[model samples]
Target: MLCLGAADTGRELCHACHLELPWLGSQCRMCALPLPNDGQLCGQCQTSPPGFVRVVAPFRYAFPLDSLIPAFKYHRQYAFGRLMAELLVEALHDAYRDSPRPECLVPLPLHGRRQARRGFNQATELARPIARALELPLSTGVLRRVKATASQQGLPAAERHRNLQGAFRCVRAAPIEGRHVALVDDVVTTGASIRSATRTLLDAGAGQVSVWCIARTP
Candidate 1:
């Protein structure tokens, strides 16, 4: 309720703030990129498909979300992370209500050095409560980010893919074999990271992989 930000309001978000958040209205089925229609693939996905079968994101990367996300990730303001996870869970319940839930949740891993610097993997923090609420197993040990790369924020789309090549490895194949897996992350931009991570899961025998993230950049 709006109260999350205001003690007196006690609402998820105040009406004014809620109206200002960039909600993703219609999005591509494959990449969760903003689209003219909700269930259709964007032209780019039609030409060059992503590895993950579907992506579900609730918000657009804009305004206050852009600010709040960094606070959670860089500043360790976990209350923001908890609130984001709660919102993402609510979105998932509605989006996948009729679909088969993934067998387990695999968080997008952070490189050991990066995690040491940041003090936590933001994706793991986001996924833990989601797995608990969904009654799904969380397999953090299944995936590993073996390579560290520069931040992808300003890279060209093609460069982003190159930066993440060989960045991820499937460390535990048995848990995901023949299983539908949901790869969790906090944000998806050009989708290079999720696509690279999903390839590892699929190569290791995952039957299918879907992406779950809080925000997507159009």
Candidate 2:
């Protein structure tokens, strides 16, 4: 679909195009931030670890992804989103090969007004295919974005964290309590949003939380 050329069998992205994508390399094991060496934690993660146990992202936010992700996210290009989700599913399979799978998948919630304006929550849409492929329940009602704060985009890291304070609340703790949950999103930048969501889940008694995203900003 991207190159107007025939895709590989059972794949949305052709192999040639896929080879050229900016795949992540030498990332921090905990946060998936790009690092000089593999299997090490970033300074931020070592100094103050995030609430989530670990992050799984297959691509770095660069080049075509910088364009493709925004197109899928803001321009209503759902086909592109689906392609990215498929790629994420593949990564999840690999990431979970040795690790325990989460009991449920929770897409980061968008505020009601934002969902109304966008006509859909991008994270929820991205999680649907993953739920089916991974055979995990999609728990949409468990969390809600009660506060509609300013967008985290373009904000400094500190400001981003402040914006997300009190942004999420656990609406249905019964499903989350004592259960391992995978929080799903399209991209992770400053990680302030996911950190807040993770705290909410942990506070609700979730056994553990992991982040799953299509891309991560380097």
Candidate 3:
């Protein structure tokens, strides 16, 4: 195994180490719920609203990744962001079959004040490297969070939805018109943020929208 200790900067990992993560297996590739076998969209997504067309994530917000996100977000250790992006790319390649590819990537936005105070949007940080890796167009301004809501950390699942309701807005009426979009975030908890972002994209005329993230909270 390629350990962090054996890496270039003693922090950035070698490619071999990055490839070792336990990627989510046999997910629907649409909603990202693990499949009994493997398929693109499941019966559940076919029956009802998935909010987003698909989701791509490598890790389940468990183990080393869970800790690494906080380390990057709260501690400003930007290296973790790069590692997370690498993992996200792995997931995308593992999941999707074909594409006009996504026309652009939109990181789930944080309200302006919070982003300023934090010195960075963690989602943006995570998305940057992935966009570079994938050579995909990235529109950071495509989605904006108009309202600043309370942290969802300790809130009950039901309350989490309430806290984030109507929190995001599309920059224009039809930003994603007839284009495929991939929405990104660092970690998805309850999928509230992604759902809100996806709704905005669909309303804006996106033909399809997918979610790609470093981790999924489960």
Candidate 4:
């Protein structure tokens, strides 16, 4: 079904609206933070290396996406979730032609209490379609969020990192050793969460871990 106000006869979004979306142009090679120059690491990444080998975020977390993401995540507007996943797949196909594909896709786990309240793991929902499209295994339980930390939304970078300390653990012996893994999420903010989660995967014997997100905050 077409969404309300969709134009161009039979598209989910009209050409103009699509053009107006906050698509990322140039981004940091390491963290996918929006950058003025392409193929360069951001200052933060240069000073302190991140756990993930690379990050891929096709959209900027701004404008329509900021509104759309909250609606999908907080209000259970699932259509937006599906739309965002499809968009990420399209972007990946174009950007990752020569990049190494991960053997498995891991959705960043949410704590049980948070998952119970939210009724679903948004990251898992986002990764399911991507896994199907890419023909890669989706491991939903291999990585578990053990501690329920305070929300990182308004927290500073230092605080965010501290909040996620000891928050993630590997629950299953899933043969992840020497295998590339892609951690999927809806957005990459300060990247503290990805750092903590990737640390767990790395410590658990993942050969290399990459982050795949729909959007990143510039």
Q: What is the C-alpha lDDT of each candidate?
A: 0.90, 0.92, 0.76, 0.88
TM per model? Answer: 0.93, 0.97, 0.85, 0.94
Model 3 alpha-carbon miss at residue 14, Å: 5.5
Better of 2 and 4 by TM-score: 2
Model 4, residue pairs in steric clash = none
Q: Per TM-score, what order, best first? A: 2, 4, 1, 3
Highest TM-score: give the candidate number: 2
Q: RMSD in angstroms, candidate 2?
A: 0.9
**Candidate 3 has what TM-score?**
0.85
**Model 1: how far is 126 from its true place, Å?**
0.2
lDDT tens per residue, model 1, 1-218? 32356533243566667666789999888898998887888887899888788988999998778988999999999988987898788889998899888899999999999899999999999999999999999999999999989989899999999999999999899999999999999999999999899999999999999999999998
Report the Cα lDDT for residue 28, model 3.
70
The deviation in Å at residue 69 for candidate 2 is 1.4
Worst 10-residue stretch by lDDT in candidate 4? 1-10
Model 4 clashes, total count:
0
Off by over 4 Å in 2: none
Evaluate residue 117 in candidate 3 and report its C-alpha lDDT on the 0 to 100 scale.
Answer: 90
Q: Candidate 3: global Cα-lDDT?
A: 0.76
Supply candidate 2's per-residue lDDT for 126: 94
Model 1 spans > 4 angstroms off: 1-12
